[model samples]
Target: MLRYILHKLALIVPTVIGITIASFAFIRLLPGDPILAMAGQHGITPERYEILKEQYGFNQPVWVQYFDYVWGVLQGDFGISVATKRPVLTEFLTLFPATVELALVAMIIAVAMGIPAGIFAAVKRGSWFDQLTMGVALTGYSMPIFWWGLLLIIFFSGYLGWTPVSGRIALNFFLKPITGFMTIDSLLYGNWPAFVSALRYLILPSIALATIPLAVIARQTRSAMLEVLGEEYVRTARAKGLSPRRVVGLHAFRNALIPVVTTIGLQIGTLMAGAILTETIFSWPGIGKWMIDSISKRDYVVVQSGLLLIALIVMAVNLIVDVLYAVINPRIRVQ
Candidate 1:
C-alpha cells in the first residue's frame, strides 16, 4: 500500500506541471496584454508600458516566462495578483474553506439520503416506495444545479424566509476565523448562534451541490443492493433463520457498500466541479467565484496558480478514492 501510495504521489508533480502549462498557455493565448490590462492604456505611452513590461519580465519570451513561473511556483511564490496585488495563494487559502465545507455537507446529505433510499428500494423492489423513490431520483438527476440553487434560494429564502439567500453566513454574528471554515470554527468555539447561522447559510448550497449526486448514489446503491440481496450468500443467511434485517443489512449491505463507496468517493470530485455553478449562483466566496473573477480580469498568475491548486486537490481526492477501494476490496491489492 505504501508503495502504491508513493507511486501515486510521484505522479502529482508532473500532473501539476501539465496543468500549469496548459493553463498558462490558455491564459497567454487569451487576447490582451497582462501589463497593459493591469496598468491601463489610458495615459500610458509605449515607453512607459515597455518599462513596466521589463520590470515584470514581460519582455522575456513566453518559454522563459513559463519556466520562471514554474520555478516561482516551486519556490512558493505564486506572484502578485493584478487585481488586488496580494499573494494569490494567500487569497485562495482564505476562500477555499467555504468551498470545502459546502462540498463536505453536500457529501453528507448525499450519503444520508441516498443510502437509505437505496436500501429500502432494493428491499421493497417493484413496490410503491421503490417507484416513488426512483422517480424522485430521476428528477434530481435531471435538474440543473444552477437552476436548482436559484429555486432553492427563491423558495427557502424569498417565499418561506427559512434560509439565507447568499453568502457563507450572517454578517452580524462575526465568528472568529479558524482554519477559515465557518462551520468548523463555529462548532469549535461552541458558538451556538454562529454555528446555527453557518449551518443555515450552508443548507441551500449543500442541497444544490448534493442533488445530482444524491440521485446517482441512490440509483447505484439500489442496483448494488439488489444484486447483493439476490446473491447465494444472502439466501443462505436467510435460510439459516437469520433475521431479515441482518440478512440484508449485515450481509447484503456490506457487500453493496463497495460500489456505494466508489460512488461517494467520485462524488467529491463532482462536488468541487459543481461548486463552480453553486458558488456563483449563491454568491459564495469560494475558489470557483475567485476563478471566475480572476479569469474575467485576466489575472494570469492567479488563474494559473489556482488551476494548479484545484487540479492538485482533485487529483489528491482521486488518489484517496483509489486507496479506499483497495482497502474495502482486498482483491485490488492482491493483483
Candidate 2:
C-alpha cells in the first residue's frame, strides 16, 4: 500500500508539470494583454506599457519566461495578481477556504442523499420508489446548474425569504476569519448565531452544486450495487439466512463501492467546474468567482496559477481515491 501510494505521489510531479505547461500556453493564447487590462479606465501610455512589460519579464523570450515562472512556482511564489496587486498564492489561499467549504458541503449532500437513494433503489429495483427516484436523478443530472440555482434563489430567497440571496453570510456580524471557513470558525468561536448564518448562506449554493454529482453518484451506486447483489457470494450470504440488511449493506454495498468511489473522485472536477456557475449565481466568494473575475480582467498570473492549483487538487483527490481501493476491498492490497 505504501509502495503504491509512493508511486502515485511520484507520478504527480510529471502530471503537474504537464498541466502547468498546458495552462501557461492556454493563458497566453487568450486574447488581450493582462498589463493593459490591469491599467483599467485610466489606461496606460505606450512608454509606460513597455516599462511595465519589462518589469514583469514580458519582454523576455517565452522559454525564459516559462523557466522563470516554473522556478518561482517551485519557490512557492505564484506571482502578484495584476488586478489586486496581492501575491497570487495569498489571494488564492484567502479565498480557497470558502470554495473548500462549499465543495465539502455539496459533496456531503451528494453522498448523504445519493448513496442511500441508490441502495434503496437497488433493493427496491422496479418498484415505484425506485422509478420515481431514478426519474428525479435523471432530472438532476440534466438540469443546468446556473438555471437551477436561479430558480432556487427565486423561490427560497426571493419569494419565501428562507435563505440569503448571495454572499457567505450576513455582512453585519463581521466574524474574524481564523480559518476562512465560516462554519468552522463560527463553531470555534462558539457563536451559534454566526454558525446558523453561515449554514443558511451555504444551503442554496450547496444544493445547487450538489445536484449533478448527486445524480452521478446515485446512478453509479445503483449500477454497482445491482452487479454486486447478483454475485454468488451475495446469494450465498442470503441462502445462509443472513439478514437482508446485512447482506445488502455489509456485503453488497462494500463490494460495490469501488466504482462508486471512482465516480465520486471524478466528481471533484465536476464540482469545481460547477462551482464557477454556482458561485456566480449565489455570489459565493470562492475560487470560481475569483477565477472568473481574473479572466475578465485578463490577470494571467491568477488565471494560470489558479488553473494549475485546481488541477493539482483534482489529481490529489484522484490519488486519494485510488489508495482507498486497497482499503475498501483488501484484495487489491494483496495483489
Candidate 3:
C-alpha cells in the first residue's frame, strides 16, 4: 500500500510540471497585453509602456520569463496581480474555502439522492420507476448548467420567493468567517438564524451545480448494481437464504461501489467546470467567479496561477480516490 501511494505521489511531479508549463504558456497566448489592461482606457505613453514591461519582466526573453515564473512558484510566490495588486496565492486561499464548501454540499446532495434512486431502479429494472428515473437523469445530464441555474432561480427565487437569488448567505446575518464555510462558521458562533440563512442561500446553487453529477452518479450506480447482482457471489448469497437487504446492501452494494467511486471521483473536474457558470449566475463568491473576473481583466498572474491551483486540487482528489480503491476492496490492496 505504501509503495502504491509513493508511486502515485511520484507521478504527480511530472503532471505538476506539465500543468505549470501549460498554465504559463496558455495565458500568455491569449490576445491582450497585461500592461495595456492595467493602463485602461486612458492608456500609457511609449516610455511608460517600456517602463512597465521592464518592471513586469515582460522585456525579458520568453525562456527567462518562464524560468523566473517557475522559480517564483517554487518559492511560493505566484506573482502580484496587476489588477488587485495582491499575491495570487493569498487571494486564491481566501476565496477557495467558498468553492470547497459549495462543491462539498453539491456532492452530498448528489450522492444522498442519486445512489438510492439508482439502487431501486436497478432492482426494478423494467418497471416504470426505472424508466422515469433514467429519463429524468438523461434530461439532467443534457441540460446546460447556465440555463438550468437561471430556470431554478426564476422558479425558486423569483416566483416562489423561497430561496435567495444570489450570494452565500443573507447580508443581514453578520457571522464572521471562522473557517470560511458559512454554515460551519454560523454554528461555531451559535448563530442559528445565520446558519438557517446560509442553508437557504445554498439550496438553489447547490442543486444547479449538482444536477449533472447527480445524473451521472445515478446512472453509474444502476449500471454497477446490475452488473454486481448478476455476479456469482450475489447469486450464492441469495441461494444461501440471506435476507434481501443483506444480500443487496452488504454483498452487492459494496462491490458495486468500486465503479461508482470512480465515477464520483471523475465528477470533480465537472463540478469545477460547472462551478464557473453556477457561481457567475448566482453571484456566489468563489474561485470560479474569481477566475472569470480575472480573465476579463486580463489578470494573467491570477488566471494562470488559479488554473494551476485548481488543477492541483482536482489531481489531489483523484489521488485520494485512487487510495480508496485499496480500502474499499481488499483484493486491490493485495494486488
Candidate 4:
C-alpha cells in the first residue's frame, strides 16, 4: 500500500508540470495584453509598456520565464495578481473555502438523492419507479447548467419569491467569516437565522452545480448496482433467505460502491467546471467567479495559478478515491 501510494504521488509530478505548461501557454495565447489591461482607462506610453513588461519578467525569454515561474511555484509563490496586486495564492486561499462550501453542499445533495435513487432503480429494474428515476437522470444529464440556473432563478426567485436571486446571504445578517464557509461560520457564531439564511442561499446554486454530477452519479450507481446484483454472491445471499433490504444493502451495495466512488471522484472536476458557469449566473463569491473576473482583466498569473490550483485539488481528490478502493475491497489491496 505504501508503494502504491508513493507511485500515485510520483504520478502527480508530471501532471503538475503539464498543468503549469498548459496554463502558462493558454493564458499567454489569449488576445488581450495583461500590461494593457492593467493600465485600464488611461493607457501607458511605449517606454512605460516596455518598463512594465520588464518589471513583470515578460521581457525575459519564454523558456526562462517558464523556469522562473516553476521555481517560484516550488517555493510556494504563485506570483502577484496583475489586476489585484495581491499574491495569487493568498487570493485563491481566501476564495477557496467558498468554492469548497458550494461543492460540498452539491456533493451532499447528489449522494443523498443519487445513491438511493440508483439503488432502487436498479432493484426495481423495469418498474415505474425505475423508469421515472432513469428518465429524470437523463433529463438532468442533458440540461445545460446556465440555462437550468436561469430557469430556477426565474421560477423560484422571481415568480415564487421563495429564494434570493443571488449572493451568499441576506444583507441583513452579519456573521463573521470564521472558517469562510458561511453556514459553518453562522452556526459557530450561534447565529441560527444566519445559518438558515445561508442554507436558503445555497439551494439554487448547489442544485445548479450538482445537476450534472447528480445525474452522472445516479446513472453510474445504477449501472454498478445492476452489475453487482447479478453476481453469484448476491444470489447466494438471497438463497440464504436474507431479507431483501439486507441482501441488497449489505451484499450488493458495498460491492457496487467501488465504481460509484470512482464516478463520484471523477465528478469533482465536473463540479469545478460547472461552478464556473453557476457562480457567474448566480454571482456567488467563489473561486469560479474569481477566475472569470481574472480572465476578463487578463490577469495571467491569477488565471494560470488558479487553473493549476484547481487541477491540483481535483487530482488530490482522485488520489483519495484511489486509496479508498483498497479499503472498500481488500481484493484490490491483495492484488
Error of 2 at 216 (Å): 0.6
Every model's TM-score: 0.92, 0.97, 0.97, 0.98
Give the per-residue lDDT of model 4 (tens digit) for 1-335: 88878888999999999999999999989998999999999989999999989989999999998999999999999999988889999999999999999999999999999999999999999999999999999999999999999999999999999999999999999876789999999999999999999999999999999988898999999999999999999999999999999999999999889999999999999999999999999999999999999999999999999999999999999999999997887787667
lDDT at 248, model 4:
93
Each model's lDDT comes to 0.88, 0.93, 0.93, 0.94
**lDDT minimum window of 10 residues, candidate 1:** 35-44
Error of 3 at 125 (Å): 0.5
For model 4 the local lDDT of residue 4 reads 77
Error of 2 at 173 (Å): 0.9
What are the root-mean-square deviations of the candidates from the true structure over C-alphas?
2.1, 1.3, 1.3, 1.1
Model 4: lowest-lDDT 10 consecutive positions? 326-335
How are the candidates ranked when ordered by lDDT, highest leading? Answer: 4, 3, 2, 1
Clashing pairs in 3: none
Which number leads on TM-score?
A: 4
Model 1 lDDT vs. the true structure? 0.88
Top candidate, metric lDDT: 4
Q: At residue 170, what lDDT does model 3 achieve?
A: 84
Predicted candidate 2 versus true structure: per-residue lDDT over 1-335, tens digit per residue? 89878888998988999999998898899899988998988989999999989988889999998999899999999898878889988888999999999999999999999999999999999999999989999999999998999999999999999999999988877788999999999999999999999999999999999999999999899999999999999999999999999999899998898999999999999999999999999999999999999889998889989999899889989998989887887787667
Q: Candidate 1 — which pairs collide?
A: none
TM-score of 3: 0.97
